[model samples]
Target chain A: MTEKIARFFAENRPATPCLVVDLDVVARNYDRLSGALPDAKIYYAVKANPAPEILRLLTGLGSSFDTASVPEIEDCLAAGATPDRISYGNTIKKAADIRRAYELGVRLFAFDSEAELEKIAANAPGSRVFCRILTSGEGADWPLSRKFGCDPEMARDLLLRAAALDVVPYGVSFHVGSQQRDLAQWDAALSTTAAIFRDLEEKGVALRMVNMGGGFPTRYRTDVPGTDEYGFAIDEALRRHFGNRIPETIVEPGRGMVGDAGIIQSEVVLISRKSANDLRRWVYLDIGKFGGLAETMDEAIQYPIETERDGGPAEPVILAGPTCDSADVLYERAEYRLPVDLRIGDRVAIRATGAYTTSYSAVNFNGFAPLQAYYI
Target chain B: MTEKIARFFAENRPATPCLVVDLDVVARNYDRLSGALPDAKIYYAVKANPAPEILRLLTGLGSSFDTASVPEIEDCLAAGATPDRISYGNTIKKAADIRRAYELGVRLFAFDSEAELEKIAANAPGSRVFCRILTSGEGADWPLSRKFGCDPEMARDLLLRAAALDVVPYGVSFHVGSQQRDLAQWDAALSTTAAIFRDLEEKGVALRMVNMGGGFPTRYRTDVPGTDEYGFAIDEALRRHFGNRIPETIVEPGRGMVGDAGIIQSEVVLISRKSANDLRRWVYLDIGKFGGLAETMDEAIQYPIETERDGGPAEPVILAGPTCDSADVLYERAEYRLPVDLRIGDRVAIRATGAYTTSYSAVNFNGFAPLQAYYI
Candidate 1:
């Protein structure tokens, strides 16, 4: 955890199962990402963590926003972001929502299908549009499905169709995956994007932009390459693909922008074994899948856990949330070792949980309140 | 769909992505369950759909409650349920919560371990407690894990130990599974509970109650046995296990109690294919896994879907929610079919969603509001 969060926890002693985000860490991450991609515009994905403080900070830093809905766009505008700096990023949207975004003077939008393109054409007239193409989502901790994007050929056809639909065919976009570890994945996605650009260009429809959707890695239980390495690899890939005629680039980083800036402080409610001879202890915590750690749905995105009783003998335990549902178990198959001296009411800090935790929390499942969040 | 919900939708023309629950259906289901099991107390599981209206109706019907948390207990009390009529049902709970329940005059609790039993004894002295034993969760559409229960031997030891800890050893509880289809599964679980009861009686600690936890099935896309079949099987099991001296029994029904009482009305947001040659259409709806239908996590619960254009030719479609997250896709492998003429803005009614939908909704994942509900 960051020193700011640690000192805040030490002084305030906030209630358990609360998220503490160090704003300084978020600012540092922003600066690091900007320094690495000096030419690309950073559209901070608002769905990750839309704390007003973080939004205001990013707005002050001259960052653009990638919003998933009309309310998110309004959030960005309320945080002092100009309408020109917001991009409506979700592929699936209602026509009413499209009209709302257009009325708000947001000009950039993302779409992957003809129906969505037609809706945008009719609702948000003269807006710039980007077509999202499919990626294999290989080599990432959280791989995306084919829900958001279309085939490269479909993207080309949609972008070409946009030329006649009163909207500008701005660019093409693709997401490798969330928490992408392999730098080569970007090159693979960019190659398909370049081919689409070339295919559209030959038909006299020139695309001027390349939206490299968010897939930047963040530290979890394992090490990942630094921002400099990612920047170097992306620079090399751009050179190989565009050959000095590179398009105006945009990178939307959600998890990489704010994931490591926060920690979840939970307390051990109970710890016991099922049988006398059972070797594994079941450790139940105040927060669970419905509370904020929804990323642990399939035991994916294992957060590094630390206890105050560290440096003592430890054993593998079945970690679970304080809920009645059986699916609330967080890490059963994964080896989660905890200190044997851990007792009820002892605090456990879950690391690198800033991005998806609070946003994914259930409203009042089992009568548990949503995860309490504090921006330091 | 129930005639009441369909009429309400037609008349109100409520906004898309809303839930409409027919209280009459819930009342009828409760009466049927009571008629099937004439002697057992119905402890309505509050985690299913804890609407104040439903709770008040059940309270008027003289139903007890099986609450999962302190807030749920407060909800039950607010709905006019007496403290004696509510049971703390979650096995994993904080000591502070136990004390709070005690202060609120709650005297009955559930536990599966010695640590939890001690917490109950210290926090709520002289209270009655039930031990939960592990069941194999077979023949269940939504099978539970071993997260909440202990072995039968372990349960006997804990209940025996509770006799000396100032807490009464009330009985044993076991869940066959959620949406359980096999009537024989109850017989198997009761066999385990019977052996535990016999062993405890031999050791001079005679248990007085048998808390048969909820596993009653509800109709979804397919037909399930009526409540009478379950009642007959449970009655036979009780007779075979305890002869004529059947203990005071309790049944906790969550999904089965209210699953069929509500329907989620959602609008089709977008429809498209990955490519020109793609055979399956992708259907996007305004409400998704995060919006309320969280039981679709692994496609474990398939809610029956209906549309206005159902009579036409239909083809298999990949269903997804209106979110940027790839995991929001509802059914990709499941053979969900939609009418070929289904258009954007057409209404789709998701059946058997009254229990888990609104309760499992995310606070606001993608800037979308929580699932709105109307109880008539």
Candidate 2:
């Protein structure tokens, strides 16, 4: 367990099943990434954790934002971020929302389809637009499906269309995937990105920026290299692929930037044996899939969990969240081991949960309160 | 589209991606169930759609509640329901929450483990307590996992232990499953329930009630029986199992009680071909899994969808929610056919969504607003 988590519990005595984000850890995580990739501009994806305190801290550190909707843009602005520093990154948005973003002085946007492009042209005229090329979401913890970007050929046509429609064709972006583990995936995505740049150039549209979308990895149940290693590999790939023609680059890091800064303390509600002969114990927690742990779906991103019990023989236990719904199980197939002597009221600390917990939690499933977040 | 949905859009012009609940339909549904199951007590499961308006409507119909938490009990009370009319039905609850419920004058509770039984014994003396026995969760649209109940032997011990601790052992309960389709599953579950009753009688503890947990089905993509069929089958099963020794019976219906009463109207954001050669179209809607359609997970509970366009050739399209996250895809593998002429800004009506939509929505993921609920 991280010292910040232990200290927070020791000092604050906050409610169980609550998320605690240590600002000191967040600042340190930000510093590590910024120091390693000194040249690459960082746009913190506001959707990851849109808590006002997190936005304010990132904004104080001179970080720009990658906003998904108008409310996100408003949130960043409320946290003291200027509209110029925010890019409307979501490809699927309503025309009215686009017009509102433009009215709020936001200029940069991203689109992957003809309808969205037309809407953007009609609503946010003369805005800097980025056309995303689809990337194979291989080897990422949360592999995104074919939902965000278009193929390279379609991307070329869309960028050219953007230029003709009075919107500036500013950049090309592609997310390898969220919580992407394999660095080679970035190499492949960057190659596709380079091909998009070439095809746009052949069409007589010169792009000014290349957005390296938010697929940067976080350390979660896997051997992920530190930020420096990711920085070195990303820097080497850009140098190899783009050579001297590299455009102004931007990197959006959602989980990698904020994940390690937060930890969740959940209370154990019950530990019952399924049957007389059942081997594994069922451990129920006060928090669950609906209570801000939705990322635990399909066991894709297993948050490292630690309980207060120690010096006891351990056994595999199926962990679950406190909900009447049947699908609220969190760790059943995934091999989660806990102390056999662990009893009700014991707290389990889930590490690296800062990015997606509160943002993804259901409003009030089963009449349980939303996951309360605390910042230290 | 249903006449209620069309009338809602025509007269109210409610916001897109919003859930519109017709109180008239809800009243009809309540009347049908209460009229059919005149002998069985109906406790409206508050987690289904905890809107105050719906609560008031149900309360006016003289419906009691099956609440999962303290806030749900409070919601029922605020809607003019008396404290004695609410049952604390969640198997997993905190000790403080149990005490608070007792303080609120809630007498009926459910438990599945020794720890929880002890908690209830300490918190609420002489309260009506029920023990849940595990069920197979087979043949249900939304099958529950092994999270809430204990084995028959364990349950027998728990009820006896409750009697010893001065807590009233009110009865035994078991859920066939949520959205349970096959009536045979109830037969098997009732057989198990009878065995538990026999076991409790052998221990000299006469139970006063039999809580038949909610699994009543709603008509979605698949056909479900009317309330009369379910009522007749349940009555036959109880008569066959317990004969004249049957106790006061309770039925808690969440989805079955309210699913068909509400419809969600969502706007199509974009319809794009994934590739030039790809046959299936990708249709993006303004509301998605995060926006309260979370029941779409794994395509388990399929809500019948209708669009504005007709008289056109139908094509299979992968339906997705409008979010940056790729997991928001609703039905990629499942067959969902839409009119080929469907365009952006076209509205689609998701029928029978009153139960799980608004209560299951994320607060604001990716800056998208929570699914707004409008009462008609």
| Worst lDDT 10-window in candidate 1 chain A | A140-149
Cα lDDT tens digits for candidate 2, B236-296: 9989999988779999988888888888889988888755667898899998999999999
Those runs of model 2 whose alpha carbons end farther than 4 Å from true positions after fitting are A1-5, B1-5
The candidates' DockQ values read: 0.90, 0.73
Question: For candidate 2, what is the DockQ-based docking class?
Answer: medium
Output the worst ten-in-a-row residue range by lDDT, candidate 2 chain B.
Answer: B1-10
Q: Write out the backbone clash pairs for model 2.
A: none
The digit string of per-residue lDDT tens for model 1 on B1-376 reads: 8788889998999998999999999999999999999999999999999999999999999999999999999999999999999999999889999999999999999999999999999999999999999999989988598898999989988998999899999999999989999999999988889888889999999899999999897899889999999999999999999898899999999998999999999999999999999999999999999999899989999999999999989999999999889999999998999999999999999998888789789898988889999999
For model 2, chain A alone compared with the true chain A gives a TM-score of: 0.98
Candidate 2 residue-wise lDDT at B126: 86
- What interface root-mean-square deviation (Å) does model 1 yield? 0.8
